[model samples]
Target: MFKNIKNDLPASIVVFFVALPLCLGIALASGAPLFSGVIAGIVGGVVVGGLSGSKLGVSGPAAGLAAIVLTAIATLGSYENFLVAVVLGGIIQIIFGFLKAGVIGYYFPSSVIKGMLTGIGIIIILKQIPNFFGYDEESAWDLEFFEIDGGNTFSELIKMFSNINPGAALIGFLSLAIILFWDIVLSKKAKIFKVIQGPFIAVVAGIIFFTLTLGNETLSIASKHMVSVPIPEDLSSFVGQFSFPNFSVIFQHEVWIVAFTIALVASLETLLSVEACDKLDPDKNVTPTNRELLAQGTGNIISGLIGGLPITQVIVRSSANVQSGGKTKLSTILHGLLLLISVILIPTLLNKIPLAVLASILLVVGYKLAKPALFKQMYKLGWKQFVPFIVTVVGIVFTDLLSGIGLGLLVGIVVILLKSYQNSHFLHIEDNSNGKHKIKMTLAEEVTFFNKGAILKELDNLPSDSYLQIDLIKTRYLDNDIIEILEDFLYKAKERNIDIKLISKRGTVENPESFINFFKEKPKSNISLS
Candidate 1:
């Protein structure tokens, strides 16, 4: 891991800047103390990164869990009680890892996964708009359709337009310009440009801009748009802020349910991030999902025990890590350490950094994830890909992270089922020497009830007076409902004067109504012969 320290250091700096606001935002979303998000970030980067199987994946408080965490906190009655659930959730994740349930990541369609990434990218961009204009009435962490302050993302935008902080707007525009210039212009100039990463440069510039703005009391920018870190008088006082979990809630059924919910959602998000990170890795190294779960579980357990929010393999931060050219796990670890050191050693300095500057960094990251080219590429892949991708993007924009992805996944599954029903089986036809056309109806090898509609449609469309040869020779399994389907088709065939031949392990039969009868005489097993 130390081998890539030169590259990783620069990358870590970029991830640090990107992670700062997100940590605070997610904490705000979870209804936890803002410091809890930072605590999770520290644990995610230091503990989880140290134990991670993934070389490039970064872990942190995820937006995906924002809704669940919010609901869990509200229902649990106390934040301390919620911490109990978080720790238990971590334990549950550890069990999941041991059970080797990580394979769930492999089952998602690639198209839908891409849609998820793009959808998140759009959300990041949308969420940052208010911050960019210095509208601190809401934090970047707000992901709901309507915020606690009321109105949706669009309403916030309108509000931002009516009341723009000139200082913040100026800093935001300058920060964005500097980032864009470095990313598009200077980065191409030389290897030194690459060595000094764009995000790092953007942040330094933002700090300098903030410092310049500081001396001017007439400046409209309030300190709210700046990075806010909890400033304690001393180390002992800072440590006093940490809260412990109320283990008394451990016996509550609702607490367990919340724990289970967190475990399930956190584990799923980690699995998805693992899949996505593997795709993003330049070397294409696949992360061991079970080990990733273990790493995350350990991180969450540590985080909760120490008064941190739950952690997951966060795609936004990980993608930012990768885009910033992070080459190993060291980058992720170092960034966590940076968060720890900065908050402790120089929180006042951190507070001086403008929120617009952070927004600029995220704006760049978001643009990279949801580039216009991505939209065109998905469109070119056809509606099968485009519809789900757009739906996910819109859903995430309108609703929240998980809901949009769920909508996209639902649409994607329907597409798959529709395709399956449309092409239930592969059919071949030929004419025999007797001048009878032999229609060889071969059921799919693993026919399920889902295929019944298609099979019935095809059978119903068969021409009358045809010689039908039903072949289940290679079929290993068939649902009983399909057998009843065959029985009904047989009655219709008898009326059409069609000749029928059924072939299976039971051997060939010219016409067997006894075998193809109603559900009463149907075979007990799902797979039947003849």
Candidate 2:
């Protein structure tokens, strides 16, 4: 993890810059104290990063949990009561880790995973447009297509045209241009440019821009459009920000329910993010999913106890880490430490950063994730892969994260079933020089009941008085339903005056007495002749 200080250290700074405003934004959206989000961000980066097996994944307060946190706070009667649920949720997640529930992450199809990445990438770009244009009414982490304020994702874009702040846009454009130049030309020419990442420079430029144009009416960036960190007065005031869980509410049924819900949702999100991060990794590092759950659970427990929102592995921070050249868990941990130190020592300086600068950084991240080349590559992979991929992308664009994934998964399953139903047996006709109409049918390997309809229809279409050969040489495990169908075709062969021959690994049978008696110990039941 420490091998690449040159890469990991710079990446950590970029990730910290990205994670900061997100923590504040998600906390605001969740209706929790602003510091709670920072708390989660700190614990996620330091504790989870220290414990996690992922090379690049960064954990933090998630936007997906905002609605849940909001409702749970109200339902549980108070924020303190919700803290009990969060703690309980952490315990439940640890139990889930022990139970090896992380394997569920592997069940997602590749197309769906790709779709999720693309969908999230598009969502990031769409959500940041408001911030880039200085529409402070919207937060950075609101990922849902439908807005709580009656407008939706597209509606906000429409509204942004009328609300663009000239100063923020100008700064944002320059920041983006600087980042692109650093990434495209400067980094390759000099090693220093790589160590001092483009995002960091962009953010510095934004801050400097804000400082220089402060007195001008047309060019001054509004305070509302800047990063909003909670500024504590002194040591005592800083200590006053941390909130403890209300252990008194631990016995309440509602608290337990909320805890279970949080545990389940957080675990799922962590598992998925870990998988997605593994896919995004330049080194192609594979994370131990079970270990990731345990780490996340521990982080959540600590975060909940210390007045933070529930934590999960988040794609945004993880993607930022990867795009910024992070190579190991050190970047993840360092980002958390940076958050903690900055909050305590230089929060006022941190708040001076313009949100548009951060938006430009995310815009770059989004473009890489959803590049047009990926779409072309997926399309070339065929409809089976492309349909689910596109569906997931579209779903996330119009709906929330989970809903989009669910829809894509459902569609992927259907595509699998359809392919199975359509492919049963291949037909090859030998040259009938003797005019005997010799036809050969080769059954596919592991013929299941799903292939019954196609096989049956093929058998029914055979012409009268033809010589037929059934080839099971490639079949490994034929289902009982398919076996029965083949058996019934025997009687039909006699009625049509067709000569039937069955070929298998055992031997060839001419006018086989019964398929039931042929190979007493067959696949799906007895020994394989393989």
- Best-fitting candidate, measured by TM-score? 2
Please give the distance, in angstroms, between residue 471's alpha carbon in candidate 2 and its true position after superposition: 2.0
Model 1 steric clash pairs: none
Could you tell me which 10 consecutive residues in candidate 2 have the lowest summed lDDT? 520-529
Q: Which residues of candidate 1, in runs, are more than 4 Å off?
A: 215-220, 427-438, 503-508, 513-524, 528-530
lDDT of each: 0.84, 0.90
Q: Candidate 2 regions off by >4 Å? A: 431-436, 511-513, 519-530
lDDT string for model 2 (1-530, tens) is 67898999999999999899899999999999999999999999999999999989999999989999999999998888888888889888899999999999999999998999999999999999889999944555888998888889988888899999999999999999999999999999989999999999999898899999989999998889999888999889999999988898888898998999999889988888888999999899999998988998899899989899999999999999999999989999999999999999999888889999999999999998999999999999999999999999999889888889989999999998889988778987785756567999998877888888888988899888789898989887777787788777888888998888889998888856755578555453533445
Error of 2 at 182 (Å): 1.3
TM, every model: 0.93, 0.95
